[model samples]
Target chain A: MNNTLKKNDMKTAYIMLLPIVGLLTVFVVIPLLYAIFVSFYQWSFYQDSIFVGFSNYLLVLKDQAFYKAMWTGIKFALIVIPIQFVAAFLFAHLIKNLTAKVGGFVKTSIYIPHVISGVVASIVFMFIYNYNGGLANYIVSLFGSEPIPFLADVKYALGSISLPAIWLGFGFTTLIILAGINDIPDSYYEAAEIDGANTFHKMIFITLPLLKNVFLYVIVVGLTGAIQQFDLAYVMTNGGPLNSTMTPNLFIYTHFKNDPYMGYTISAALLLFVIIGVISALMFRLINSKQVED
Target chain B: MKKPKFLAFMLTVLFIISSILTGCSGTGPAGTEEEKPDDSSDSGKTVLNFWTPQWGDADKEWWEKNIEAYNKSQDKVEVKLEIVPGDAWDQKVVAAQAAGTSPDITTMNYNKIIFSAEQGKILPLDEYTDPAIWDDLYENIAEFVTLDGKHYAYPMLAEPSAVLFYRKDMFKEAGLDPEKAPVTWDELIEYGKKLKKGNVFGLAAAGNAAEYGWTHWGFQAMVGQQPISEDWSEATIVNEPTKELITFWNEMYQSGILPKQPLGGYTDIKPLAEGQVAMQINGSWAIGQLRNDYPDLLDNIGVAVVPTNDGNQDKPTASLGGWTLTIDGNSKHPKESAEFIQWLLAGDEQIMVDFFKDVTKFSKFTARKSVDEVLAQDSEGANDPWRKLIAEEVVPYAVAEPIYAWEVSMAYATALERVMLEGTDLEKSLQTAEKEINDYIKNNNYAGTNPKK
Candidate 1:
């Protein structure tokens, strides 16, 4: 009678899984398989795509612009991830200690930037960074320093492009980290305080270790988002000032939109996807394994 | 309990029905008709879709007035103008064509018309149009729209090559004569050096790679190098004159006369409008933008022909940039569409109203010589010196960018960008461009197939 009940439960479980599986097959699996298939051809909207084995991959590997873009993306991710993580954690911790009303106001104020569209943020940044009339230049002028070409110069282009992303993204990251911080039991902090632990000690032991899962989640997701960054870069630099700020996603888009090499673009996209997937998996594995020990 | 459950179910059904009714009714007000009237019922009445990227407020007002006039005069065809945004319009039209549901007619950039023709998306209107009409176009304007001995579009406007727009006040402050602005590459450098100082650039030569800075304004204006050969077999001009042009611009870069390299502020005409940049090499299209956005700059601004090489005393070559109207091959009403296009391009008062006053300023010369004459007569001594320069000097020297296969042209633009932005070895960049283009042609079986020749 128990065996019969188990079989019935298995049938019900399979039935319940059907909708999700169907959705996954339709949206994700089919498109992914189609993209892989299309990657072998020289595609254009105007003409038939001719199959050309691994040529697309070879071209992408050899392309100097692609190399530059990849390096830029890596630098962007490295700079933004740690800065964002620390800033978000600090802000969230600060908010956690604040009075409820004041904390709410501060949170809402920070989160406002997160709600602004990428295009809007980029345009606003453009004004703030404009060479002569911009606010940044005005501030610098007050300090007796010469006006800087923030977007125009190659040296500053990457940092300028990344600024808007950091501004827009950090707020949301802070909110997520705040949610995780709130989940921590108050008793842990109280116990640490009673033991004569300092604030830093409390943060290092009570806050960091307890919020490990959320930290892992934020870092992994943030890195992935940085890798696929497009809209802000597209709107602002347009992969310009000598393509110093170009990313792989921008490279793929240029291929798809400007050059009609959709096949090669898809191949590049798939390569980026694999890189992101592997990194995310490795990160999740490391974090979960560490959790197992804890 | 049973009665309550039944009542709950009844309420749920009522909610769904009301939601559905709301959705259906939301598509329109309660009583408006859903379908357009049949065109066949009225013999002389035709409905045409005219698509353009210049659907700005002024453009729309002009279109409505001219379309109204056309509808009133002929009683033949009623034209509806749909303004697609510039950035996505080309892609949108391409998708529409691929799906075989394109609008009756649309305007396309002259550089892009060849690609559309090559794809068989646009009809070659040679057989349908009167040969006499071809004579009305400026010599190169018609040539641009012609592919394989067939005209694919009705030429609308022609943006002549680059001209020098300078701040008269800045010129005065720099102790340089506004009327004696640089007329040669050497003189431009000299003048630029003299004018360079705080919060000002001597010139704003496009350094934005994506804008084809080197190819359009830099090389074309410097030594009159065309982007591709007439036969479209190879890129012919990336040699000495091109190298010289790049080197000249590099000199300007080193001089700190041009805006700091990898040019920003190309889109912000306000800097120039506010007298921050003394001189900028740009198209006539900027004239309207300046007039609209910086009215104060008008009194202090001067326009002149692009400077020539020291020895090439001939007219400086202007890059022709403008749109051409074409009927989509997939158009449901090809005959009517072609007729509408012809009417729009007609040498009548309607063309003047539609092309000049209603639309912004003529970014370029109107395609029709008659229209050009009318514009010149209308604006004779109108205090706009830039208009005078465009009318008398810029229009006559205008040359269109070479037409290659779409992919090849795109590669050329990319190569130009690399040369200007990265300071990449010009020869190496050109070689890479040539190889990529040839490979594309070979792979696509486009070799020896100059569709636009």
Candidate 2:
């Protein structure tokens, strides 16, 4: 009787898992595989696709635009990761310092941007960055600086694109880091105070060491999220001022439009994917080794 | 334990049922209607799907009114209209085509008509459409949409892609003739300096990448040269005409006549109407927008052809950029869709006239000459209120927009931009464009593939 009951329980669990597994196979797994398959073919919309083995890959490798797009992604990531981490850390500390009611209000308000759609955020920022009458120029003029066309110029464009995205994403990271901060025992800080440790010393000795896994999570997740950012960049600038801010996704998108071939775009996308994947895997390993060390 | 098992079993069944119901509910009322039998008349109507891009207020209203009128006017066919927003237009249309759920009919830009024809995305109208309807189109309009001697799209409206719009009040303030527009490129810069005041910019041309690239084609027309050869074989930007064109625009920018950064894109007349700029080079559609949104400023606005190097009114100063209605190649009701396009775009002269009336502009507007006659007699165009002046002066001179790959056009635009904004050397900038175009042509094996040829 006991054995029969266990079998029934296992059956129910498997049934619950079925939908998710099916969804993964259909949406995620199939597209990835197909993208790989199409990366070997050369043709556009309705034209007979020629099976050009490895040529598409070689072409994408040699393509200047592909390299430029990848470099832009890397540059964007470099700007985003450090700023996102620092802002989240400071914000989490500030929230921790505040009273519960005030903290809740502040936290929710900061998170309102995150809850809003990326496209909406981008549109709002477009107005804010407008050269003539935008809030950014308005404030800059007050400091006796010439008004800048923030999104419209290459020099300021990538940096301008990063600001709104960072503002949108940092709230979630702040909340996560805050939770990690809360998990640390108050007794540790109390003991540190008793042991002739100053506030900075306690932070260094107690807080930093304890939030190791959380910090790692933030960096890896933030790095990956920053690089894959499409909606905001695509919406804000449409990868313009002469494709200076063209993300890898937007590059692939424009290429597909010009010539709607599955092969070249897929090849470029796959190569980008491999590049991003390797970095992610390396980061994952770092996280695991850190976990082991901890 | 047996009771627990029973509850779990019920839960799984409930979940599956809910999922199915959710999927069904997503389609709402429109789903069932769309799934109706194709062209069989089993339901007493052949359901034809028509997709249009998101247009301006009046443009959207025109569709809403006409599609309803067409559907109600006939019981044999029902046309469903979907307005795809401008930004998402490309992606949505492509996906629909790929999925074989493409609309029976849709609107397309003239530039992509050839590419669309080559890909078999659009069907040839020569077979399904009336020959009289083909004869109704102007020679240029007919020639523009033809690929290998077959029409793929039927034009809806043709707007001269560049027209000089100026502020009469500002012109007076600068002690220039309030009625006269700059006729020569040199005169334009001269007037621009006088027009520049403390806060107002002298001119506003396209500074953004997308708008600048397209608007530059009109400048190419003004220069009396198509930047790419008609054969699509080589770059033509290194010549004297293009040299004069780029140099004039660059000098205008470097001299602080035009804004360092444009206040708005060329399609948008907001900056000109708001008095941010004394003059702006925009399309004929600006007249409609100006009349609709800034009625107070309409009286102060002056219209003229885009100025050229020698101010020769005979040369083409503008390229025709317009939309065309087309049938999907895979459409089950190609004949029906063609009939609908004919009925709307070419059928009743009054209905087509109403389109120009709704926008408040009709200067050589319609591809159909019959509609032009009706518009001249019946509808008062945008603001100019003059008939046949644009038709005579601008329309005849305005050449058909080039059908070369967009990469070539945008490459030349890049050259002009680098020279203007970054102050790159003229020869170097042209060299860059030539290299880019040559590379694209070589890679695509694009020699002599000009369908327009």
Per-prediction fnat: 0.21, 0.21
For candidate 2, write residues A1-294 as lDDT tens digits.
698888778778767976875576456655576567667777444445567899888878877878988888888989988988888998899999999999999989888888989899888888898766789989998898867778877788899999988888889989989999999999999998888899999889889888978987888778777777788788887787777888898888877766545567778888878888888778878766466455
- Model 2 over residues B1-453: C-alpha lDDT tens digits? 665776577566655655564343322111112232355445778889888998677788889899899988988899988888887898888766544577889998888888789877789988877799889888988887898889999999888887888999999999999988999988999999999885688898888666767888777877767667778788777888887888998888777787765676678888889888899988888887887888787789888877788878788877888899999877878888888998888788877787777655553388888877665565344233433556677778887777788888888888887887677899998988888888778877788988656
**Per-residue alpha-carbon lDDT of candidate 1 for residues A39-75, written as tens digits (9 for 90 to 100):** 7776544455578888888777766666777777878
What candidate 2 gets wrong by more than 4 Å, as runs, is A1-15, A43-47, A193-195, A286-289, A292-294, B1-42, B379-387
Best by lDDT: 2
Locate the minimum summed-lDDT window of 10 residues in model 1 chain B. Answer: B27-36
Candidate 1, B237-354: lDDT as tens digits: 4577767766776678767887663335443455577666788877777776776667766888888777777735356556677777898755556777776667777547446544
Pairs of colliding residues, candidate 2: B360-B382
Candidate 1 — which residues are off by over 4 angstroms? A1-62, A189-206, A289-294, B1-48, B69-78, B94-101, B213-218, B221-238, B261-268, B293-296, B311-313, B347-349, B376-385, B405-449
Error of 1 at A229 (Å): 1.1
DockQ score of the complex predicted as candidate 1: 0.19
